[model samples]
Target: MFDYSKLITGDMPGDKIQIGDSHIKRSDTVFPILLKKVKASGKTKIVISVYGGSGVGKSEIGSLLATRFRSNGYGAYVLSGDNYPYRIPAENDRERENRFRYGGLSAIAESDGFCSDWMDIVHDAWLSGADADPELAEKYEFMRDYQEAGKTALSAFLCTPEEIDFGLVNRIIKKFKHGEKQISLKRMGRAPEELYFESVDFSSTKILIIEWTHGNNSALEGVDFPVFLYSTPEQTLEHRISRARDKGVDSPFTSIVLEIEQQKLNEQAQTASITIGKDGELIV
Candidate 1:
């Protein structure tokens, strides 16, 4: 129940206008207003998951939605499923080998500056020994023994057209996670540059678009007002093709692989839904 008196008396943070699910136009109006109201009340903490199989434009959709919220002066978060803490060099090699075996280099791993930064966080966390349970540490030490070999294999894998090192990423994640190391302020001092924040500030109704690896169902299990997109495999292919063309990519096979990826995405979207209006209201 919104306080109508607040709006009439110029005491409201913002007006709340309910919108219907099928009414896309109303969504455009109500969302921003409701955001203002939520922010005024200091109760902004919304999480909207956009999950689907790889290549299904999940990231694209999530990114766009986040952009929309940000444009309305909302602090939006755009997270991806692929943002896993993988080891570098070694992880790169393993991915290339797998890509090679699976006909071609379609499903390659991603390694960018952001990924490197995240890997550093995982490494720092491991070094801090935050999760050293003895058994995990023993396993991690064993993996470290083959670091040199893994690095070598990963180095060679970077020659492909896809770009970046994946093995080094995997090893980083493996050691940081299952691997057991204890880090103390005395030993490691501070947290990684990226992992410094204690928590996200959602005082204002901020929009968060999270792309989960486990088909969003895993992430949106109990979330309220979740919006799911329904795109078919063919539609996904067309979407990617359109994206590649927009990005100025002219490879035929690359386009084909993207199409296959679309099929995977269609599967994921079939299981998701979203809130189109303010407070899940029906504003015609």
Candidate 2:
């Protein structure tokens, strides 16, 4: 049997691991051997993405993998995709309504229908080039050096209790889309854009990882290589309740978790029916 713990902890050969009908493999064979070759050749940096659901330990595995790559003396840069930006729950009705109105509009901007509008900003920044932002460019260089050493850069946009405020998400989305002004975070100074540009420069080999929670799996629509952590909905509820207990949060949320788990199981069964017959496999 495949070890779920090993997969979560990311313990396996660089080649691949097979479990049931699913297989987990490295992004590419070149990934494992790139350190010596890239250092000797002095080539441009490479970028990779590691994506998975939350509680499945995406971030933890990403860190360990990045560390291993660095230990091989290869320039490895690991940046978590969670650092982008998002909104938090509103406290009151007024705050919640304001967020809903603004959030609806922002969500439109983030949609595929508004790709041109968003891409315009990207193009303008690219045309203006690095000279327009020498400071950012230099910061990138610093990041490249650190990344070349195999350091994992941890960042996230998930709403934690402390950071939960709809206003913050609006600001982040606005700054991200319009580029009108820069915003700073508590621990990390400067806006996310500034930090992102800086990190890119220091990394010759980049691995981007994201662990998603608090939303639907469809949230990762455009991701290249996506991985889903599969388990029964019963197991999911058990996991959530166990986690909540571990955190000292004794709430009525267990019932809510149970409800969600039931709904998820129904949906999963429906999907399975569509993909495979009662006996499994598709009809010829």
Candidate 3:
């Protein structure tokens, strides 16, 4: 059952709220501030990104925030980050390896035969690493290192933001922002066989809510409200374990992936507008 009371508040206390053993009060402290920001933005259409490391409650909090938006008389839609992957789960591993070995975007395009000007730029930037193109090098150096690392090190490099279909995601968001009435979105079910597309009615949707670890990036540009949750790898272990069990996918590999994901996600936190602490308290 969902807790509605937790999603609403009269006034926020400076200190943490104790609810049984849970000291996290994100719903009370964070949601209210977000609501105010949405209302004050004065934009008929708004995009909110709830981003953080794995098992940090991005999906749950995003859903709650969307409900809050709807309750406040705004039409809202929640976009799943999982749907933006460049390839299906099974193929992504191969793709990541290709990217690391062959030179980022160039390698991916050559093998896949799906070339793009954007990819060309990315490829050039990566090769120009630390020379004249410091920015591009910085962006892609990790990918180069990943390619050179052993199989054991590869697990940590998998599923980073570089693997997402950023171009597709950006296009979808732009279309919606431009008042596109209808859009098709991919929804991944529990299994790969369940992947399917559903047409969404964005005709009246005033707010688009996207929650993912990599939300604070160029791919999600133009988002009106961006929320970053701060949770260390230690803090995330319990939630990750529970989620994995529920998904029937608890394993050593998943644990390693989550640890690496935490490291990458923490690096992206600096790009967020609002940062929430591990205790669910807002950090000024």
Candidate 4:
């Protein structure tokens, strides 16, 4: 009923992935439509982005689509937007934490609700990485102010030029579309020394699949078809917990990040050429 005859997974280094029945079904929903568009466009090079909320299976579904495309006699590659972040995971985590704390405290200090006692409490909450916990906010009213302000600041920081190297990604897309045979693609790791690039053959590639959380991001140009795999934060949480994607994936602070990401994805999903719901049903 499907093809896994070739590699459709993203090129990110050191990734352990699992694709499920739902992902396959969703990919099947969109692949034929995408193929039709690719055929009609008559463009030698086409870029498709598979993006969605955290743990929504962008990487998994993108790979499946790519594999089907290749097995049907078209060349394709899945590029990871994760590798384009300005900082490594460890460094970026620290920066995001700093932003949340700073942004939250700054707002609280400026508001009439500024109380040294509450400020200290909020400070401690952030240190424990529970500032964004809904239960904590409900238990302690002061946390609500910090959580709101922190998420606002995160909206300004996440997936923007400050965090993601959109320019570099755009340039790579340009080269691919302009007939570059082999291109140097970036590879990033959790450490400083892990930043590097590898020359990859794009000579036979006709369709380029960028599977990432930020694939639908505004700064990422040149995507002829944008696909959004929609999943609510709660849904994503369950999946991430099962996958053991990373440390703190189930943490409240991480949940705050996922909330912010979902907000952005919802806004971006409007423009997606294809959108799949959590139930593996096509929404758009």
Top-lDDT candidate index: 4
* All-Cα superposition RMSD per candidate: 18.3, 20.9, 11.8, 1.6
Quote model 1's TM-score.
0.35
lDDT of 3 by residue, 181-212 (tens): 99888765445676677777899889888877
TM-score (C-alpha) between model 2 and the true structure: 0.33
Q: Please give the lDDT score at residue 194 for candidate 2.
A: 30
Return model 4's CA RMSD, one decimal.
1.6
Kindly give the number of clashing pairs for every candidate.
35, 5, 0, 1
Ranking by lDDT: 4, 3, 1, 2
Model with the higher lDDT, candidate 1 or 4: 4
Give the alpha carbon lDDT tens digit for every residue of 130-204 in model 1: 221334335544222223233334333323224322343224223322322421110111123322112223334
Best by TM-score: 4
Candidates sorted on TM-score, descending: 4, 3, 1, 2
Q: What is residue 217's positional error in candidate 2, in angstroms?
A: 4.9
Q: Which residue pairs clash within candidate 3? A: none
lDDT of 1 at 94: 41
Instruction: Compare candidates 2 and 3 on TM-score and give the better one.
Output: 3
Cα TM-score per model: 0.35, 0.33, 0.67, 0.94
Poorly placed runs, candidate 3 (over 4 Å): 1-24, 90-148, 151-162, 245-256
Any idea what lDDT model 3 has? 0.62
Model 3 worst lDDT run, 10 consecutive residues:
9-18
lDDT winner, 2 or 4: 4
